[model samples]
Structures are given as C-alpha cells and as structure tokens.
Target chain A: MTRTFKIFAKELRDYFVSPIAYIVICIFLLITGWFFFSTFFIYNQANLRTFFTLLPVVFSFVIPAVTMRLFAEELHSGSYEMLLTLPVKLSDVVVGKFLAGAAFASLMLVPTLSYAVSISFIGDLDWGPVAGGYLGAVLLGAAYSAVGVFASSLTRNQIVAFITGMVICFSLTLFDKIAIFFPAAIVGVFTQIAAGYHFENISKGILDTRDVLYFFSVIFVFLYGAHLVMQEKR
Target chain B: MIHVEKLTKFYGSFCAVDQIDLDVSRGEITGLLGPNGAGKTTTLRMLTGYLAPTSGTIRINDLSIDDDALAVKKLIGYLPESAPLYHNMLVYDYLDYVAGIRGMQSRRKAERIHELADLCGLSGIMHKTVGELSKGLKQRVGLAHAMMEDPQILILDEPTSGLDPNQIVEIRDIIRRIGREKTVILSTHILSEAEAACDRIVIIDKGRIAADGSTESLKQGSGGEHTIHLSLLGADFEEASRAIGAIDGVSRVERVEGANVDELRLRIFAGGPDRLREKIYACVKATDWIMVELTQEGKSLEKIFRDLTREV
Candidate 1:
C-alpha cells in the first residue's frame, strides 16, 4: 500500500514536471471552457447542463491524450523494467498510474467548477443536478482514462496508444446513441453497457447504485486487462 | 547469498536461458561473461525476479523469487543493460523516487541519496535532468538509482557498456568498492573488465556454462603449453635447441624466425610450463655462448576465453 502511494506521488510529479500533462490540461480547458460559456449564453440558462453534456465528448479525445504515455512511454524508454525491478508490486504500479491519470483529469475539471459558481450568481440554480453532473463527468473521465491506460499498455508508441484509446472510448460512448437505429431488444442490452447511459442517469441528479457499479466495473475490467498485458511482457 | 537450481526461461518456443545452475556467496563479485545473444541478459533478469523461469527455481537470501517476490526484490538491486531512467526527471529527484519506492523514509532517503550520489560521482549533476545528461552521466545515475536502496545483492548487466575509458574505470572502481560490502553479479563481454573486477567468473556460451572458476585458476589450468623465446648470441643454435628439447615435460619444440639474426624463438608444447622452464634455463646456462633473452609468456585471458567459448 505504501509503495502504491509512493509510485502515485512520483507519477503525479512526473506529470507536473513534463510538458505533456500541461499541454493536455491547457487544451482540455480551452475547448471545454469555450463550450461552457457559449452554451450558457445561447440557452439563456443558469444550469450547467451544457457543460456536463459536452465534457464526455471532449474527454474522449483529451483523456486518451493525457493517459496515452502512462505505460507506453515507460516501456519504450525502458523504464518499465526499472520499475518492475523495484520492491513495488506490479498491481501497485498499475493502480498508481491509474490514480495519477485520474487525479490529473480531476484537476482539469477543477477549472470548470468556476462555471458552476458563475451559474449560481446569475439565477436560481438547483445545486443537486450540478453536483451530480460533475460527479458523473468525473466518473466518466476516469473510465475513459482507464481504457486509455490499457491501450497505452498495448503498444510502446504513444501516438498508437492515443489512437487506440480514443477509438475504444469513442465506441463505448457512442454505442448507446447508435443503438437507437437498432431494435428494442438489442438496444436495452447495448444501453446498459454504454458509458453514456450511466453518465446520463447521474447527470440528471440520480446517484443510482447500479450506475456507480457500472462505472466501477468498467474501470476494473480495463485496469485488470492492463495488468494482464504487463504480466505478459514479463 | 544467491542460488539457482536448473533455472531456465523460454519465450514461447525459443529458449532464451537454458537450464543453468550457479551460486554466489555473500560479499563476492561474480562475473557472468558471454557473447551477445548468449542469454546473459535473460539470466540476469531471472535472477532479479523480473522474468519468471520456465522450469527452475531461484532463491535470493533464502527467499524464493516466485513465492516471495517482493521480499526477494527488496534484497536485490538490478541495473539492466540499458540504464532505464525517466529522462525528464533530475538525477536527485529520480533517485529520491526510487528510494521512496524501496521503502525509505524522508530522512533516510535523503541520506542514502546523498551517499549514493557521492559514491557514483553524481553529486555534480544532481540537479540536471537525465535527458540533458551525457551517456556517461546517465549511466552513473542508473547506478546511483540501483544503489539507493542499499540492497543486500546487486545485479548489474553490462554496467560499463556505453561509457568512455575513463568513465569505465570510474564505474569499475565503484563496483569494486561496493563489492566489498555487497554480493555483486555483473555481466560483461569485456574480458579484462571481468578479470579486473570479478572474484569469480562464469563464462556462458550458447546458453550453457562454459567455464567457472577464479581468474588465476582458469589461467593456470589453461596454461599447459608454454612458448619460449630465446635470443642466441653465439654459435651452436642447433645444439642449444636439442638440449632444451630433452626436458621431461617438453612434448615438441618448433623454431620460428626471430626479429634479429642472433635470436631464435622456440614455441614449446609442454605438459606444464613450470617443468620446462628449469630445463631451458639449465641448457642455456650449460652453453658457453651468451643467452641474450629468455622469456616465458603467460596465456592471456582472451586466449583462455576464446579456447573455452569457441564453436566446436
């Protein structure tokens, strides 16, 4: 457990010291910030529905970009062997890197909180939906980051990692909307697996246990797969 | 202490490391010498608990690598052939991170980092990012990171692979100094480097142990035949050669041209050089002619290594 935290701290420091993390955060903020305010003026509403709705779509690209180098670059640069030779467990390394990506994604969401503050100032806003929306967005980002980390573990090239992660995340996110064209029987099963289905439930101020479990299960499945990939390299 | 019992590793159908049994006592510097693709790196990885052996057992400090992996890992510090490092991090920061992962607290981590930096001559470049450092400095930082934990066992693969001459010397010195307190297993293709730094050497060829012994023992064991270079100053070169040939252990003596006319070089094939040397001295002393030079050349490490590892 202590080793996990130690790895987590170093990974976080690695993100801060390198330009890749900052570039990712800056791009995410610029694009998401513009959409948040623009949607506010166009809709003439004080709520953050526009911000929450746009985050999952924006994060599909940004999360992969942020998390693509987590394990891929380490393997490419030979640092993966170095880390494995340490006293830390392989599971700790996977979890530590996952937490680091999650933490960075959380930080990127911090700036969007000001949008909530701005919304509260202008009109009567129900804080319940806003709070739930942020929670849902954070969880959605975490799931995408987990998928990105797994993709990163698949290849040494960071660009390939990014493309693979984006493709996987985009497919999972858009799977529900695409199900509308299919029959009702298949649509029910597809919507349950789609990230958008669970995220939309939480965005509407519903903290369903099923939705929480769905997000956690997705994170677990991808993280477990990442662990398997690393073990295979050994 | 380290022990391996029939350790073998296979990558799919290809066997990278064959069944190999070896051991290293505490505080001894053991050298694993082999040609490229001879499984030196794979053996080191298995010993370090980085790769699981296919059908064998490895125990470090009485702990099995498979069962007690974390404990085994904590006892050994490994430096791979490629000095894997976070290039974006400063030397000190990277060492600190390693120390932290190795379970060192703040005060001890700081003290250990300083000690390792001083030991590896990384004090001057502590603040520089590893990416900005030269190859030598990067190698030193890798050594420093490996030493941060002050592990009981050290496994270094090609520690001086890409360093300059002076840097190699510095790294060898560091290894020698550290070997006094820690059990070290270093692999290198440089024969002289192994001869200078290792207390015992295990030469591997084609994924098998070719030779394993002390350097002196290997030299003496392989030094059966002796080459005697004689410089004759007067007449009776033929008589001198016959007298020397009658020695007890002398199997055959062949004469080759010397650089000067007064010199005659004899390549002596003997059961042992020690027995033949005395007869040559006696024969030369009996002759009334002056003997300019009589030198017995010892077999070089290269010759011994080649003799052991040559493809049959």
Candidate 2:
C-alpha cells in the first residue's frame, strides 16, 4: 500500500540520519568480518561453512541490538502517539518498521558477500551452498528482527527491549540442541519448531518450501503480536 | 463539524472519561479546559480515532470513528501535548512524508509543503534536522506537519504548554488565524488563553463537565452575588454595617480598613451594583458620616473557576 511505503521510506531515512543505525551497522560488520577472516585463516578452508555456523549465534545478540529501539524509542519519545493519530493503519506501522529492520539486516549481509568473493580467489568454491547459506542467514535475521520488534513493543525502555528480544531469540536457537537430552519423542517436536532446524536445512543448499514458510510464519507471528501490543497501548 | 455523545473511556476498572456530550460546529473554536488527569487528552484522542472509547459515538462530519476510521482520520489533524516528531528528520522531508501518507500527489506535495512551511513559520528551518531545532521551532514544525493536508478540523492538546510567553503569543495568534477557517478544539489549563482564543469554553472537572458557556456567562453563573466597596468618613463602623445590611437586595456588610483612621471601608454583598451608591449615600447622609468613595467590585474569571471546581 502507498501508506505502508510512505512509512517505510520515512523509517529508512530516519535510520540513516541518526547515529544509532550507523553505530549498530559498523559494529556488526567489524565483529562479523573479524570472525569471517579468523575462521577462514584458521581452518585453511575455501568454504564459508564456519562463517554460516557462527552467524546465528552472533546475530542472536546483534540483530536484537539493531531492532530494539524500533518501537520502544518511538513510544518513549511520545512519537508513537503522534503516529497513531495519523491517517495510517496500525498494520502499516508494524510492517514499515519490520521492513526497515529487515533492510538493515540485509545491508549487514551485503558486506559478507565480499567474504564469498574472497573465498572464490583462495580455492575452488561451491557457490550453491554458499549462496544458500547467505539466503538462510538473511531469513534468520528477518525472523530475529521481527521478534526484536515485538519485544520492543512490550516496553518503552530500549535496554529492556534488547535483552528481552535477545533472550527470546537465544531460547529459540538453542531449544533444539537442549531438547536432545530429553526423550526422543519430545525432541522431535521441539527441533521442528527450533530456529536452527530450518536454518540448517537452508544453509546446506536445500530449498524447502516448508522451511521458507516456517521462517515467514515466524516473522508474521511476532509482527502480528507487535501489532496487538500497539493496539492495546491505544 | 464534530458530534460526541455519551463518550466514555475506561482503563480497566478506572474510568478516565465519564459519559460526556458536546458539539463543535464548523468554523468554531472550542476550548476544553481541565486539570491534569481530567480526561481532556483521552477525550481528544477518542475524537481523533487514536483511542477507542469504552462506550459512546464520535461522528465527525457524520462519519463514525469506528466504521470509517481512515476516512474520519483523513479529515482531522491532531497535535498532542508533546508534538510527536522524528528528531533526525529535516522539516521539509518530514512534512513531505506526512503529505505522502495523507495521499497527496507528488506533484502537489512540494507546493503544499511550501505553503504549510510558510504558514507555520518553519520555512527558515526547512533544511535543519528537527533535533537541532529549539523547542518553539520544533512545535512550529509539528504544526506544519499537522496542517500539511489542510484538514477541516484541528485538534490541539496544550499546543502552547511549554513555550515562552512570546512563543505562546505567536502560537495563539496562529491558532486564532487558523481557527477562522477550520473547526478547532483547543485544550488548556490556562483560562486566559481560552478566554482570548476560544468562542466557547468547556470546563471539565473530575471527568465531568463543570461549566460550558461563553467566558462572560460562566463568570456570571459562578459569581454567586455582586459586591460593592464603600469608603466612608466620620461613620460608626457597627452602625454603618447594620444600616448597609438593612438595604433591600443587600445580603451582608463587612468592615475593611481604609487609608486613614477617620476613613471606614465596607464591602456590601448585594444583588447588583444598581442604585447601591444612592442607597449608601442616603444611609450615610442620615448619619453623621460623609460618603467618600463607593465602587462596584466586578467578579473575575478566576473566582468563577475556583468556585466551580471547589467542593460544595
């Protein structure tokens, strides 16, 4: 919708004009890029498997830090009330901020492309798995950002939002690995719902519509929850 | 035009706004005056469709807030107590974004932005980021954004709350100018501001209407009775009090200090000021006192406000 795009464009512009977005982006690249080089040199491998494996763990903290202030800052500064009074719908505001966080996450992935390009020079690189890994990382980042936004809606403090989002994302990421100690029947169901299960399949060049649907559904559920939170605030 | 009937909002078990009725006609400026937590903001939010009323109906130009929220919102521009703004955004860009969301065409957006910027005194700060601007400038920018679409109604909640005296005057002038063409509901605790800007004042106390009328009418309604100040020379204080209190329409008489020892001052509570001087002079002539000066003490708006809100 035109209204959604208008909100999206403004949100994106706000990110660039302020130091918060740039600071988060710079730190994300610096830390991730360090791990990328360190893993490649230590392993002496031409593949990006190490980088892909470590991304979810690193993003569990960084993505929430990036998305924590999306709605929380707006509410704290009284801008949420202003936005609610406008002609736009609540869905537009939720989707706009979600897309803004997704766009920032996408930018974080753009710099990692050079890692793919660098590995190509060192040795023979299978672009198939590497491309799939990047796709998986981006989708994972999208889902994480949505959850972060939902947490941000629950409170007006950015720190609380960040911690809450990180906890939720970390729980979802580690739930499957932890469930293995339990009974097999319980573990199977938990793993199916775990973020790592779907991400691992996509990282290995497996294009499962079910996995994509799962990621989208996760994004939708959190975003819808954020919408509900905002409506309750009104 | 706006019509609100039996509007109520509850936060769980606590009622923020009770059942209230009001009508705002086109091109009329109405003032909503109340203390903090008196539900002025909540009521305004409901009118703007930002908050749903617990029970009631709000019809703006005959469009219900529930059924036609978007349509109703499009016809209203609201400025909350704290003008919501993106601090990182340039004024022009922010207004442009609002214009786009309000469905203005790109071609006409520039012209509308320019017009609003000029009207709100924000043309000089069009390129500056909002965070870098002063509070008054930021408020001006908010005003610019609210007027970008030129809606038929403007709802301003304490638009001049934190501004300096000069800024307050400037904002009041702008509001008065805009109110000529647009129906406006200006909310404030400043009675003088309402008296200066609004055609009618709706005073809400404890989630209910305490008084609703023109400034003069409300003052008269709450004044109770008139008072006359009398200064007399060579008069017996007790005898003068008794004589003045005996006059028809005069309720009570109380003694007050004069500038000199020989001078005696008395305040007379009466029906009105008419013929009070004659009655006083006649009463003083019969006695051995000289009537020095007598003047009617007009009732003030402050007294009316205090009387209306004070517990019975």
Candidate 3:
C-alpha cells in the first residue's frame, strides 16, 4: 500500500513538472466557463444546472488528455522495465497510476468551484444539489479516468491512447442521448449503461443507491481491465 | 549465490535462450559475453524477474524466482541497457524516488542518496534534469539508482556500451569495487572489457554457451597454437619457407602478403612447443639471408572468440 502511494506521488509530480498539466487545466476552465456563462442569464436560474449538464461532455475530452500519458509514456520510454523490476507488485503500479490520473482530474474541478460561489452571490443558490453536483462530478471524472488508463495500457503511443480513451468516454456519455434510435424494449439497458443517466440522477440531488453503485461498477470494471492488460505485458 | 537450470525462452518459434544452466557463488563477477542477438539481454531480464521464462527455473539464495519473485527482486538490483529513466526528472528527484520505492526510511534515504551521488560522481549533476545529461552521466545516475538499496546481487546489461574510454574505465572501477562484497553479473560484447573486468567469462553464441573460463584459461585451452613471423631481406618466399618449414614443431608455413619486393615475410603456425624459436634463429644464422624481424605471437582472446563464434 505504501509502495502504491510512492508510485502515485512520483507520477503526480511527473505531471506537474511538465507544461501539459497547466495547459490542460487552463483549457478546461476556459471551455467550461464560456459554455456555462453563455446561457446563465437566459435561464435566470439560481441553480447550476447548465454547468453540471455540460460537465460530462467537457470531461469526455479533457480527462483522456490527462490520463493518456500515464502508461503510454512509461512504455514508450522503456521505463516500464525499470519500474516493474523494482520490489513492487503489479497491482501497486496499476492502482498508483490510476489514482494519479483520477487525482489530477479531480484537481481540475477545484478551480470551477468559483463558478458556483459567484452564482450564489447573484441569486439564491440551493446548496443541496450544488453539493450533489460536485460529488457526482468527481465520481464521473474518476470513472472516465479509469477508462483512459485502460486505453493507455493498450498501446505505447500517447496520441493513440488519447483517441481511444476519448472514443470510449464519448460513447458512454452519448449512450442515453442516442437511446431513441434503439428498440423501445431495450432502451432501459442502454440508459443503465450510460454514464450521463446516473450522473443526472445525482446532480438532481436524488442520491439514489443505484446511481452511486453504477459509478463504482464503472470504476471497478475499467481498473480491472487495465490490470489484466498490464499483466499480459509480462 | 545464484543457480539457474535449463533456462529457456522462446519468442514465438524462435528460441532466444536455449537450456542454459549456470551457477555463481558469492563475491564473483561473472561476465556474459556474446554477439548481438545472442540472448544476453533476454537472459538478464529473466534473471531480474522483468520477463517470465518460457521454461526452466532460477534459484537465488535458496529462493525460487517463480514462487518468490518479490523476495528475489529485493535481493537483486538491475540496470537495463541504455538506462531508460524519466527524462523530465532531476537527478536528485529520480534517485529519491527510487529510494522511496526501495523502502528506505526518509532519513536514511537522504543519506544514502548523497552517498551514491558521491560514489558515482553524480554530486555535481544532482540539480540537472536527466535528459540534459550526457550519456555517461545518465549511466552513472542509473548505477546510483540500482545501488540505492545496497542489494546482494547486481545485474547490468551492457553497462558501458556508449561511453568514452575515460568513462568506461571509471564505470569499470565502480563495478569492480561493488563486486568485492556482492555477486555481480554483467553482459558485454566487447571482448577486452570481459577480459579486463570479469573473474569468469561465459561466451554465448546463437543462444548457447560456447566457452566459460578465466581469460588466461580460455587462451591456453583453445588449441594452444602459436605463430612465428619471419621478415627476411634478400630471401624469396620459397627459400624462407623451405628453411622454416623443416623445423620439427612447425605445423604449416604460409607467406605473408604486402611485403617489399626484396623482402620475404613468412608466418609459421607452430605447436608442440619444443624451443622452435631457437631452432629457427639457428637456421637463419646459418643462411646467407639477412633476418629483419623474428617474433613469436601467442594465441589472443580475440582469436579464441572468433574461433568459437564464427558462423559455419
């Protein structure tokens, strides 16, 4: 467990030392800030519904960029050989890199909290859904981060990892929105598999057990998939 | 102590390492010498537990690599070829990270990092990023990384491949100092490196061990055939060959090429070692030809290596 944290700390430090982390964060804040404020006056709404709704779409692309280099860089540089030969388990490496990606994705959301605070001063902002929205955002980011790590493990090219991760995240976010094309009888299954549907339930302040369980399941399935892919490398 | 039995690895249909059995006792520097694609790197990877073998087993200090891989990893420190490290990390940060992963206490970790920096001549470059350093500096940093825990066994794959002569000598001195108390195994294609630094040399050809011995023993054991070169003025090849070929111990006589028109150069391949040089000198003294050069050359390590690994 301690070794896992060591890898996690090292990986996170690796991210901050490069310009990529700052650039990604600035772009994320720019896109989200522009989209949410573009329509805040028309709705005259006190709640942050527009901001929370666009979170999944904005994260679909941003989270993959953050996680793409976690495994791909190590493999391409041949540092994976040096890393694995250490006195640490493969699980430690998998979990460590996953946490680093998830943590960085979570950190990107910290700056967006000013949006909620600014809106609170202008109008009556209900704190319940605001709290739930932030919770659901974190869970969603973690799930996408897991998918991105799994994609990164499949190849040594960072660009390929990013594209593959973006494709998977885009499909998960678009599943419920595209369910109208499916037959009526199986529409429920598509909705259940979609990440946006559960995130919507949490952002509405419903706090359903099923929604939380869905996010946890996504995190587990993708992390386990990443673990399997890494094991096959040996 | 390390023992390996029938260690074989196959990449699809091609075998990279074939049924290699080896043993290394304590405080021994064993050099794995081979040509390119002779499975030296593959063997080192398997020994370090980075790659699982296709067949066979490895035992280090009575612990099986298959059953106790983490335990074995704790005992061995491995430096892969070219020293692939995090390019963005500073030298101090990289060594610190390795020490953290190796389970060194924070206080001791700082102390050990400084010690290794001094030992590997890395104290001056501790603030520099790894990517900006020269190849020799990066290799020294890698040595410090591998020696962070003072492991019982050290494995290096082509440790001095891309360094200048001075850097190569410095690294060799470091390795020799470490080999005094630990078990050291290094692989190299440079024949002189193996002869200079190793206590035992194991030559591999086409995924198999062709010869294993000390440098002197290998030179003496490989046929013991020495050559005598004779450069004569005012003597033709025919005359020199007739005079030197009649000696009892001389096996064959051939004229060396590219001599002056009036000079005759003859090479005599002699064996059996019955004072053949004195007899040749006496015959030269008796003849009217002026002997310009007469020298005997012993079998060299390069000759033995070529004889063993030459393609059929």
List TM-score per model, in order: 0.95, 0.92, 0.93
Give the per-residue lDDT of model 3 (tens digit) for B1-312. 899999999988999999999999999999999999999999999999988899999999999987898899999999999999999999999999999999989999999999998899998999999999999999999899889899999999999999999999999999999999999999999999998899999999888999998887888788667988888888877777887888888999998886478888888999867588899999999989998998987688788889889999
Docking class for candidate 2: medium
lDDT of 2 by residue, B1-312 (tens): 799999999999989889999998999999999878889999999999888999989999999998999999899998988687988778888888888889899989999988887788887888998889888888888888778789899999999998999999999999999999999998998888999999999998878888899887876766458888898888888888888888888988888865689889888889765677788778778887888788986677667667767767
Clashing pairs in 1: none
Candidate 1 local lDDT, B55-114, one digit each (tens):
998988889898899999988889988697898888888888888888888999889888
Give the candidate order by descending TM-score.
1, 3, 2
Question: What overall lDDT goes with each candidate model?
Answer: 0.87, 0.87, 0.93
For model 2, the stretches where C-alpha displacement exceeds 4 angstroms are B229-246, B253-267, B272-298
Task: List, in the given order, the native-contact fraction of each candidate.
Answer: 0.92, 0.88, 0.85
Q: Which stretches of model 1 miss by more than 4 angstroms?
A: B232-243, B246-266, B271-274
Per lDDT, the best of the predicted structures is 3
* Candidate 1, A1-234: lDDT as tens digits: 888898888888888877877788889889988887866788898788877877778888899998899999998998899999998888999999998888888888887788888778988899999989989988998899899899999999999999999999888888888997989889899999989888989999999999999999999999999999999888
**lDDT for each residue of candidate 2 in A83-167, tens digit (9 for 90 to 100):** 8778989999899989988888888888788888988987999999998998999899999999999999999999999999999
